[model samples]
Target chain A: MSPTTTEDSTSSNHGYAKTSLNTVNRYRGRGQYEYQHVYPIIDEAPILHVAFHGSPDQDDFAFPVILPMLGCTGNFEEDPNNDGRRSIYLHGYVSSRIMRLSRKNPASNNIAGAEGIPVCVSATLMDGIVLALTPNHHSCNYRSAVAFGYAQVVEDEPERLYAMELITNNLVPERWQHTRYPNKTELKSTGILRIDIHSASAKVRAGTTGEAREDLKDETMRTKVWAGVVPSRMVYGTPLPAPTNMFPGMPEYIEDWVEEWNEKAERYSAEAAGL
Target chain B: MSPTTTEDSTSSNHGYAKTSLNTVNRYRGRGQYEYQHVYPIIDEAPILHVAFHGSPDQDDFAFPVILPMLGCTGNFEEDPNNDGRRSIYLHGYVSSRIMRLSRKNPASNNIAGAEGIPVCVSATLMDGIVLALTPNHHSCNYRSAVAFGYAQVVEDEPERLYAMELITNNLVPERWQHTRYPNKTELKSTGILRIDIHSASAKVRAGTTGEAREDLKDETMRTKVWAGVVPSRMVYGTPLPAPTNMFPGMPEYIEDWVEEWNEKAERYSAEAAGL
Candidate 1:
């Protein structure tokens, strides 16, 4: 029955969640989402896979899992089906913090609607590989998600302004009021799109690798190499505010997210360390 | 005429290549590719692209571009009509080295075919991100390629013996003869898939950022943040051989790639220091 001495694997299930575009099932596994053993699943998940309203923190809706700081929306292509999928196509512009510095067209402050470019985005940071001692136990640990949805361009000035507020809030959680809002011409040049949630699934392989009985008996294979999880984590230090900005203070919302990120990071690091 | 100030100017050319994929006039731009700035154009100037390939002396592919170790063969999707496109259908797999150490799979050897599970293959690394000061200028300087095609199980006793030699020679070159080939059963269980190199694209963005005229004039904008490229590169120190194995001489192939990789690391270090 062991993978080494035997050919037929009775192990059937590759534990992973299956879902559509609306409701995401909660996954319960030995490891957390940020486990270092996680592998990046591209075909199964995409950033815009689900289009949902602005409540990014709520569960079951596919939007919250993704970090919204990066540019998520692009030009909207009306769905041919009248079923109201609420979708937008993105160009491959990796709209990250660096994009803001480029300022290619100040007119089109947002990469979308500017030059009619679509966006395809992907972001991942891998930490370590988890080897399950058993062939069936072979698995990777990682924290990842793919979101896809259509964003409708907020063309009306008032709507665009309102959308910008939501975006700024999304990133910093209350910095909109602190910074000056865009003017009329600026509003016209800017692009804003609303995304709707569709469906999402999460896959994970955690805990110790499963070992075959035969291989364990073979002493030659016992001490071959350094076998242990290399712990990895994305740690965030306190923000260093800009010199020019006179801020009321760090908003609780922003603080809350950072705290969550840190707590999750600690958990992942501990798991990776096998502590 | 600047984007910041230009309100109603019209330029019909969106910088897209004229002619269709179906026509012969543009075949040059389609079949053979060349780089015009960051945008890859086909055949407009084939000479410039291949110019880098000839020089074996350069340490890094920075000045002269280097072709990927393995070129992809087909369209990203499993398109039926894309003949001679040279594509690869790759599934991810954990290497034998990691498998044995993690205590997973008691199999004596962790190579593909040994376990009968699908072999996941990859040979790629991300080199760097080339950040130009301008947003449009920002691009990642990365090295990546996917190997496609499935492995043919090494069946012939003699051929299987030689196949392990081939893998070592392919990876470390010249070292195959120095090491012993895998045994009959070792070969039987090992999976060997022939990968096809079909359609592929190599992209890079280098040089300074595009400074907008308006930003240059606006001291407020200029003084705002720390701008410019963040140079990143993967530098491998001398390889630490597995503690179990003892090597008396180095193979020419392994010797050659290491030297090449080091040269690249040196050049990147120099560039970073200059910045």
Candidate 2:
């Protein structure tokens, strides 16, 4: 159900929109968010982070809702018109000490606190799995986005410990300047929201292979039972370290970002090691 | 919020039960059929399908209604007693003919369909992509599955061409007696839908470090940036055949399934001829 609506906020500037960090987030129910673009003013942009997974491991409770550009070297390719890697995204700017750690977690207590929907948060990472031969036609091949707007919370105190050290040095740029920052009760129980530049939108869909149109010598869509697609990704390798890090070398920007993550882990490990 | 509910339907029909192949077509949005853990007794199992794609080359879309077995394929060592791969899937259950070709598309005419809501599906395939080390903490170390029940719509005619020749011989086993079967206008414009397995589940997560809660000795969860996870799969090498058939050769069950996909491609061919 491709629905849409969300623009009327004129000023009151809530931030977001360096082209809304390359929009795409879809995972309905439990913090609902949607914006399936068949086209609607190319869907707006704002709101960013919402990458959850407190469990089932993905590096537990992953975070990314830190926005605000300026001197910017979260090197999203140092702004190729803020490339947004393909589409756009950049949500969460929360910093009221993480909204009092989500109001001391009773799970973000009352009136739907997470500080009531700030603004701009778009995410989408459903990249592939179209195994069809029928088991209710196993499907999946996605990439979504529709982050609306919010984040403006970094409440002073040394810019809330420099926006939590620019979100831990923009997510571990060699460990936020040699670590150990964030105190004063971890910056008074962390939260730092921010959004503006016109809230979010990053419409996408690589829909190809609708296949199924046999008869012309009927090749049964070339079946073998193990058809195609199983790509799936979200990678980054070569960090290991920390066996009690006294640092046994390795760091020229972590050996050139792990030789570019061993060349994208040797081309996605030779197609999942099945060359 | 966990919130479970099942207090009866025969106690939500526990594990491996079956039924539903058009039992008086009870119209739920024209043509009813959909069930997971097909309620015979008590609990939950709504549909789940999470498919995505937009890059890594795109074509993504997956329907998820929270943990409803992404679509099924049980038989984990032949049913590990109703934990049988801890069910939560929603795959092709024999491709309900691509939701009957998106119920005559007009952008799915006005979805709200599946009034009979009972659909179990599960799918898994992600040989790798575990790249960690903070890039907003990357992850993807998987195999994945979980499916639970309900489907009915095979409208007679010899159980709809013997359930499309048992899903084309469960996906190509001797090409359903060497091809060519569905006649009566390809079984009345082929719609076929059937699933009756009261409760079912399947599970698997797979390697390259996935145990979680080592909590990496939390110095703020390590992060020199560049952690691991970037495997990914969908291998089914050797098995070409059908260039127009006539291979008076190749059939000992297609040479034992192309010698079991070339012995899993020569034991994952050095991670598929790495890079």
Candidate 3:
């Protein structure tokens, strides 16, 4: 049921402009099909992966099922980074198997194009390792995206409670006004889908990690190699509770959202590995 | 070419003991196919999506291409967690397209079974978020892993210099004896696949995040929602260098591998979220 504000607005308003299925043929200058660069790398990826085309009439044992779902981009009306509307959603388990193959092929049965189940979502993050001085110019400082969607199966119930409160405030922020809302057997064993993207790309690779010029004019391989960038982030630590928690501590919005996502994941992974 | 000491030592020595393609049909007790719980969650995952099945004569527009490669899991003879005879390898870029579709399908051309190019290989980590008490028992103290392989295309050169010194000591440990080794035109534009794995699992889902016993005897919905866990990990900061790094700092093996993987990812994510 497409129209959940599928944001296309006559493309190219600061890129996301590629077609031929979300182009980015080999680092094409760090591709970036925009909706503000692929919805903030699919809303700061904590997990997306997805892929698809599983068992589709098993042609040569056709099996391409990459899972790790749980998603979020937005649009129950606004801010999914408000620009090019939005879509993405995801969440799972209505008897999974990609929501029973996105409810048996839907995307309005390919209105002359990309039908439902042809997924391929993805999302990385990394943010540092680089260390290149050779070892074939090693890399990692990342960001990654890749969206090409179609999905469907989000049968409205106030847009599935506004995509479950935008995926539970994208995991934290006001956690859907403190849980307990999805009853009716947890919205009938949950399952959300929605995608509708159809052209998304975002490859980042942040700073520090470039070497060749004959290994930076080989001063004995630049003083016996040791380029840089360790960076890498993702924090949050110290919270725990739960074993029948008769709460009395840890909750000031989960300790200010674990110190605000550990200081924005250590200040954007050391300002994107420039450190 | 599959024999750079291919591992498989007469199977079943402690986990990775599932077939029917690495079975774990939904939380079968947090399925783990063992080799010490799946090669330390495939060597502490910091990227390894990889899925596959791309062209397959384009059935239903078959496109399953999850990327984020750069892998680990070893067996250059021993310690790939020293058991199930490891495999995984990965690395990319020799005219990439998944190393030319794993060198045109070569799992010894399916000698009566699991053929090449099948691939799957996932990997996650997360370690904490839980916050249950409903929201369908919100979870995510993760660990993931998937595996099931076939891949091929490595074409030995001392097993591609032992998988480029085990993926440059997996990005930092002994930083592969300080770079510059890959020479022959950087080993002819490097490639490396080698999956071969065949049956691997590992689901995990560490402590705290169980709700449903009438939302823990509903003490006003557990003191107005705020179950627990948060935790998460992955740190490794401070390093930065490279603008033509005429190296003069940051390298005592990259600051002891960023303080030993940031104190083993903050003490195994606060002891797997039991904090």
Candidate 4:
């Protein structure tokens, strides 16, 4: 059965409501609108593709633009209303921050629209390539989440640090405490954007190749052409120390984290091929 | 030396002009606009994140939206002017086709605006995670490409088939010839979008951790904390056949492609760590 149609998945508790904009009309069976289903995919993706309107000043760019950014989902505080809404924090430099959220643009201030710069964030993890009998039926086994929201720069120093730490730890577990803390200049130069989720949904596909009934019945074609999934995932190799690194050896936390993630990624992709 | 500053890189031969709209202002040292430099990144990426403005009828949505799609860059014909211009083809279903490029949007027709649906496509490959002495200095070693374009549905059957075959082969080398041919119904059901790239650029960072002079000078902190790159890449695992697959055995082409890609992935991630 599809999780999209399941009862628990439809619960509003700590879940995003399906809006006309965020609803997944195609492949409805694979669509999900729950926080549990959506957030993990976003967190697992190393790079989040963020899309926003180009600077209004640049009329040549009628198209919206996309910037691949480092970010992850996290909540700074528990939901006061018990309805669990969270934000995605992003890491950026001062120049990129200025380019994206220029003062010249009215809506960039989040004042005109009463919301921050409109943006959409997407994350996708390709589990495998599903090779079918014919090119038309070829598909990908992937988990993708799209989040629609307004993004505003985190001006508050504490919140900014909170986001920076969260983004850092997300990349390497327990990395924040292990690394040297940021000084005043480093803190000032680093920019963080917190995107408040307005609506979100996820679509997942994990299984073997899908065959049409007609194609499956054609023994000659079936026997001639191979049909299968080439399972795949991002793998973390052994860490390579920097030239100036003076640590006695690789830290236990880093070593273990690498192994754990590699195992998990391999296991999931291989298992998903069978599912 | 940075490619962006090179004279040959600035050549207009089969390359996009460095417009203000597409310029990489933040890290000018890493930006690239050449065809050879940018197209491969998009083709190598398994998934492309596409962003475009919502339909005009959907006033409720002020934000641009992103869709994770399967696509690859290809040139259907040689450049008439000897200046390389290529298009990226995307595979989509009919249902999703109508939702994204509806009749209601004026620009969707490419008539009034003299351009089809405006779009921005991004592809990124994270080579490794750079663990620095401080959290602020932590960065990702990656190759990322951003393409700005106008998309129009491919109506010509031959062109659509060309794109389809290209996409299928891109997934697995020689896959199209080995598979069963698509029927008329199958062909009709598939939707292909050809995005004529207007401008594009790529950014690459591949190396060990970048350390601050002050942090490097502090021997105590350097001795205590680990600094390195955790090389990472998308690895293709063993192939698993479908339940209904009637192939006698795994094909040699598939096997070779898998092995070759897996080796390339592993080698690149590892070598890029110390670059």
| CAPRI-style docking class of model 1 based on DockQ | incorrect
State the lDDT at A42 in candidate 4: 92
For candidate 4, write residues A100-157 as lDDT tens digits: 5732343553322444787899999999999889989998899999998767777788
Q: State the lDDT at A201 in candidate 3.
A: 80
What's the C-alpha lDDT at position B70 in model 2? 28
Interface RMSD values for the candidates, listed in order? 16.7, 16.1, 12.6, 2.1
Candidate 2 or 1, higher TM-score: 1
Query: Top model by TM-score, which number?
Result: 4
Candidate 2, TM-score vs. the true structure?
0.25
Q: For residue B192, what is the lDDT in candidate 3?
A: 83
After aligning candidate 1 to the native by TM-score, how far in Å is the CA of B260 from where it should be? 11
Against the hidden reference, what TM-scores do the models get? 0.41, 0.25, 0.33, 0.92
Instruction: Please list the residue runs of candidate 4 whose C-alpha ends up more than 4 Å from where it truly belongs after superposition.
Output: A1-11, A97-114, B1-11, B79-81, B97-114
Compose the digit string of candidate 1's lDDT tens values, residues B1-275.
Answer: 11122121111122212212111121133221211211221111111101011112322111111111111112223334322232222111223222222223222222221221111222223333232222332233332221111222223455434444443333333543443333444344443322222112332233323344554565554443323333333322233222222233433444566577556554653353233
Q: Top model by lDDT, which number?
A: 4
Runs with alpha carbons beyond 4 Å of true place in candidate 2:
A1-123, A126-131, A134-138, A141-152, A162-172, A175-226, A230-251, A258-275, B1-275
Ordered by TM-score, highest first, the candidates read 4, 1, 3, 2
TM-score (0 to 1) for chain B of model 4: 0.91
> lDDT per residue, candidate 3, B106-181, as tens digits?
6533323555677778888887788787676787888888876688777778887898888778757777787777
lDDT of 4: 0.82
What local lDDT does model 1 show for residue A154? 40
Report the Cα lDDT for residue A23, model 4: 85
lDDT of every predicted structure (CA atoms): 0.30, 0.32, 0.73, 0.82
